[model samples]
Target: MGQHEKVATSLADAVGEEIGASLAPVDAELERLYPGDPGTRQPVHTVYVPGDAFAADTVRSWGDRALDALDAHAPDAASFAAVLGLADDLAEPVYARVRAKLEREPVEDLRVDFEDGYGPRPDDEEDQAAARAARLLAEASARGTAPPYSGIRMKCMEAPVRARGIRTLDVFLTGLLASGGLPDGLVLTLPKVTYAEQVTAMARLLEAFERTHGLRPGRLGFEIQIETSQAILAADGTATVARMIQAAEGRATGLHYGTFDYSACLGVSAAHQASDHPAADHAKAVMQVAAAGTGVRVCDGSTNVLPVGPAAQVHAAWRLHYGLTRRALARAYYQGWDMHPGHLPTRYAAVFAFYREGFAQASARLARYANRAGGDVMDEPATAKALSGYLLRGLDCGALDTGEVARLTGLTRADLESFAVPRRGDLTASSG
Candidate 1:
């Protein structure tokens, strides 16, 4: 067999074995309880760093500086709003001192670390943490401010090991959920996922949590971090990811490309060069393809290097480049993560750019239809015909706003109503 075929066979076998070993009888109770998407609905962009990277002092300093910089540069209500939200959480007073210096700072996505292993927690500790996180969330929610997006990166099983014990992993995840559930669309990022069973195990825990908390079933969602040699070698990696999504039913929301782990697995130099190496690209493609049309988002991993200088220009440029790359990915139907607060601009830049481009293209197309001939002022049939094509194309490409379509087409609000109405008959007939 060809190399690709060989790889496919191996992955299929591995996944099959995992599923066979772990698959429980279908839970009709669970399925009926959670019938639709039950978790955070917003698109996720996580910011991750090792917890050990900062001491208590550094965190305080950084938090302070971030708040100060945000106050000055945000310049608008929404921007200022996000800045103010971080005021209490900035790492240090120095961060606050320099906060005024940073402009257009990014909002924190999800924070990640492996400070604790995945295992069960004492009920008391779990309750305390849950209460704390809940209080913070309530305060933020009441202020109409977004909470800091957070997540935990648990320890990965070392290689040469047959499999990581599921019970150990379960305890860890249980503590997180029981600790007052994840804060507003919390993401549990699993590293080094090599088989579908790993995804299933996680999903099952979420199911159990939903039962215990009286939360809607499937409310516990997670993003899988693909970073293993065996995972990359799978020809059907994309399909595997898709299957995982199906298994989750609706809790799964995003897939992230884990560059460092995958690189180490392949014996590639785990350096700056590895971020976008060919293998990494291949793995990203697998994730993208699998996530396509599933409504589950995908994100490219971070650039390990950090930029320097106070001008924020260097940082801005890095962000812009990163945003552009992410925009390209988004255009292909994927979004990426910004690992640091500094990368926030890049994240927003990419999202806004995509929306702007999509809007512009959609407008241009609709304008063509608005000017088409058929009647005194405009041709209803001709215009409708023209618009039908534009509207479908726009929606397909993630240009989700229909109001913009109405504005550009000059179609009466009523005529545009049919924009969302599914088309019947041939494209030409439907338009007429």
Candidate 2:
């Protein structure tokens, strides 16, 4: 028989219970408000087409134009590599994938712009355009010609355009629902949101739409366009962006940066008004932190330096776009906006190169971790999560194929998902 030793701990079980009871509501609130990332296929980039200019073959046309730009400027892998400083080994593979991706799936996400792109228009004219966008998008969906995710960006909910924006949104959604119901990839964007209350209004509007259409609750979610300084910081000096996410009440899907508008809001000169600017980084950092673990993704803003003019000018623009895209990816910002077709090649080039460059090493490390085979790099569960997520994103964007990733890591799609996205039960257990 073992003799009992004197207990050194002073606290009783009741004390622990008291603390737990006090913080029970905090636990519930955390679960309700901060749902983790929604494990979904996020697009690598979003391409915006003006409302009136969008057509049935818009996605295909954009791809063709991008391919043409590649053909005209960087006809060979060597030339493209020279322009982007891509290593020699990656040149052939990345180039091939970028070209094939352009031919196969060029535009991952397309937003039909009804706001700034369409400009002010007659009521009837705007109504017709909205209806036409719905019809064309529905037709494209049926024909398998549409991008993976497609939607409209209505005008902001500001006083000057509130009625117009609501009407346009109603027309579009109604038209879509009438034609074989909304597609699974349906998305919406509300631009230039300045106040948290504006976000609440959008949520309420969507809820009303759902009730009117006899759809389920919380069916429509949107990306809040973070362009105004007021949205970033309120007069009271709080992080209004965080408040905005709370205001969505589980309906906010993303926070999209607006490069030009945000830069102008801060009074930055046009020359320095780019996605990688210091001001831009500050804004996006706040956005990123605010959105973390809220299931709200963040999208970087676009660049205005279009790849036009002569060959030299096109090359310069391509380099800029490529560098920006790659930089954003490294910073954990997976998505950005592509305003012009010429930006497509470099966009894909940078993305493809990034994934391809680290493929071998990442695959090996992940394999070792999975097998519990120790290696030079000590891996943690969190590291495994990141590694799996990296591979999955590469797979989603067509940079790495399923067979290849599976062959390398010996993990199936489901296996990778298990590591990348933890279950709620698992999270709760770990938290305790």
User: TM-score for every candidate vs. truth?
Assistant: 0.58, 0.95
Where model 1 places Cα greater than 4 Å from the true spot, the runs are 1-44, 49-108, 115-135, 148-151, 155-184, 235-239, 272-275, 310-327, 330-334, 366-406, 409-432
Per-residue lDDT over 1-432 for candidate 1, one digit per residue giving the tens place of the 0 to 100 score: 656643334366788877866654443433443232222224435655553342323323344544443444553434432432323222232232223222322333444344232233544553344344334433443443432455555544444321332333354445555444445645566667777776776787668767866777766677777777555455653456656666665667677777677777778875534556787777777777666545566777666554335535534544544544544454453445554454443344344434444455545555555465333333344444435533543333333345666676665544543542323322336434
Best by lDDT: 2
Candidate models: Cα lDDT each: 0.50, 0.93
Q: What is the lDDT of residue 128 in candidate 2?
A: 97
User: Highest TM-score, which number?
Assistant: 2
Query: Per model, how many backbone clashes are there?
Result: 22, 0
lDDT tens digits, residues 159-263, model 2?
999999999999999999988789888999999999999999999999999999899899899999999899899999999999999999999999999999999
